[model samples]
Target: MLKRHHKTEALILKASPYGEGHTIVTALTSGGAQLKAMAYGSRKLTSRIGGHLSPLTRVELALYKSRDMDIIKQAQNLESFLELKNSLSRMTKAFFVMELIEGFSNTGVGNRPLFDLSLMSLRGLQSSSNRDIEDLTVSCFQLNLLKVTGFMPELYTCVECRSSLNSNNYNFIIDIGGLCCTKCLSGHPGRAINISSKSVEILRQFDKGGTLFSELPLGSTVELRRLLDSSTGFWLDREIRSRRFMEHMNSRDIREPMSAIDMESV
Candidate 1:
């Protein structure tokens, strides 16, 4: 018999006290899998691994398989995201984004694109110069996360009718998972998210991996934010808890909570 040693690059998503002197750490490994590992003695004052295991710190780890959970044998800090930690708003946004990633992800399955996106998004949030840019970064991250995870809303046409929209204003139906035409909305009872053509055009660019922060259209942030938030919650089956905290930090109002059917659909 041999001990299983798994080595990976991981982002520490969360950590909680466990046992007398250990911590239960939730990490997103480089392969894009969520792993819960026990870092024994991490709570001790002299522990070396404790410093490297802080939330949002990227590190390389050697994990030994245990009966119920993995045990960390080695940890090397990769990126600490120090700037994000300096601001409550930024860090809360980081948590919100990571929470979304964790919600969509499953254990033991790898999604490289998503892993890279999450890392890049966190760095963007940390290094951003101001709140507006930070907001844009989070929005971009949400939109892109949905894209990578196969939950992207269809913006090109109506989800219900599958018809190309040629109007300056379109309705975003979270229940249907994308834009809806006036014709289709007549048959649908859910609240239709009104979006400008400019917003839709910019979002198309966003989906193509365009500039995230400095390029965001003025006055469209709220609309875009609500759209992504609504659709994401709709698909995920519940409102993301960190969203409220992030919005509070930003002083932005959340226009719509989850709709009745939106709650039922997920």
Candidate 2:
């Protein structure tokens, strides 16, 4: 028995060619569940759904439930992030963010905070000045993702003894999802990353949503990159290819400074 479903709003995260003239669209519905559907003839030049099915485009799609895959009958674009698509850096960052959402968000789960954070991250990337700001935006998104997924690290206290963290530098254990003071670090065998006091302060700010990318310091930025990488990698148990690309992009940006005009533009 086949079930016919009407239209629903969705944000396209990934779309790839399925067959000769069709495409497979993977989207995150407003209800916070992942939806995969086949768009017939979407790859053709004359196809009306050509531009509307691109990643990050919000759309209303009509789908029919099939045994293995859902079939998309029609799609109408709700919002196209034109600004993000126009710039190469912005596009790459946006894709990375989408990849994170696609990889972490579970099917049939309703997480409004994750959805809202993803949308905000996209908008931030679109308007961000340089790679620095872009990295901060992604870092923030990753932190929020962990929080929404119920894996937020215990920053204010030791993961083992549950003692309040002081001004001393600590070793962050990715597997434990928090910090380990000098005593705990000696006892545990997990990989440890050094975190400075300033970095901890910045992380606290991130948790509170006080100041964002522009207000973050260089050291804090570096610490955040390390923390997010190790933490997410440990929990996910695999490397995210998009994150590698983002690292490459960040390195490239560091090799060249933005022009005075470019800096002024942001």
Candidate 3:
């Protein structure tokens, strides 16, 4: 028998007006399940749970399990991630993370790693101020997200022939979901994107949690971003809406110069 009333910790992914004074919230529960609940009267100014239910907030929620949907009975915020809210650039990236998570997650399917990665990525966006670091944060999150969700790209071998990619001459095919060796690239024409040897190394490092964006050159960062963007889009079947806004912000804002290491030629 399922409990009628229950409580769980959740990261609010999206919140939107439902009716006059109610809100429909989509959240990722700590137990690694996606949840959509109705927050009655939350749109009212005096409602107890109104402010606590905003998107990207981490909150503890008490819910009533109705037949149609869960109802949020009470709430308490756990982490507001205030620093991210202060910077437009970081906040946009944070939204992009949330959007990507939504694309990959399914309701009632428990994926604890996905929930943890989402929290860690948001916290990373909160603390970093550098544009390059922010870019890496999102990029790494995308890579890790793909790994946790079972879409990890094949970096070490040819997806076509299963031959060793020891020579480092490879092309990443988005539709095939992995690398195709140079020898096999001709058979699958048009979709293969040339991947450099260094980029391959960086991706391998990312897979094993061995590298950081700061340790690599800016050019590599840019390269990885393009690769991941295409990869993620192929999986989601639609572009992340927040990405365009984030790129526009990047182009318009002036920030500190890249550090000496990042400026090194790739």
Which numbered prediction scores highest in TM-score against the true structure? 3
For candidate 2, write residues 95-151 as lDDT tens digits: 778887898787768777777787888988888887778778888888888888788
Per-model TM-score on C-alpha atoms: 0.88, 0.88, 0.92
Give each model's whole-structure lDDT.
0.83, 0.80, 0.87
Worst 10 residues of 3 by lDDT: 257-266
RMSD of each: 6.5, 5.2, 6.2
For candidate 2, which ten residues in a row score worst on lDDT? 257-266
TM-score of 3: 0.92
Candidates sorted by lDDT, best first: 3, 1, 2
- Tens-place lDDT per residue, model 1, 1-266, is 77599798999887888989899988888888888999999889998888899888999998999889999988999998888877766877898988888787778888888899999999888888887888889889889988988888888878887888867778887776788878888887768878888788778888888886475567788888888888788878998988876666566433345356533332
Candidates 2 and 3 compared by lDDT, better number: 3
In candidate 2, the residue pairs with backbone N, CA or C atoms under 3 Å apart (3 or more residues apart, or in different chains) clash, namely none
List candidate 1 stretches off by more than 4 Å.
Answer: 1-3, 213-218, 252-266
- In the range 1-266, model 3's lDDT, one tens digit per residue, is 98999999999999989989999999999987899999999999899999999988999999999999999999999999988987767877898899998888889899999999999989988888687888888999999999999999998888879998755566889888888877888888788888777888889888999657576776777788999999999899998887886786688753544345422310
Model 3 regions lying over 4 Å from their true place:
166-168, 254-266
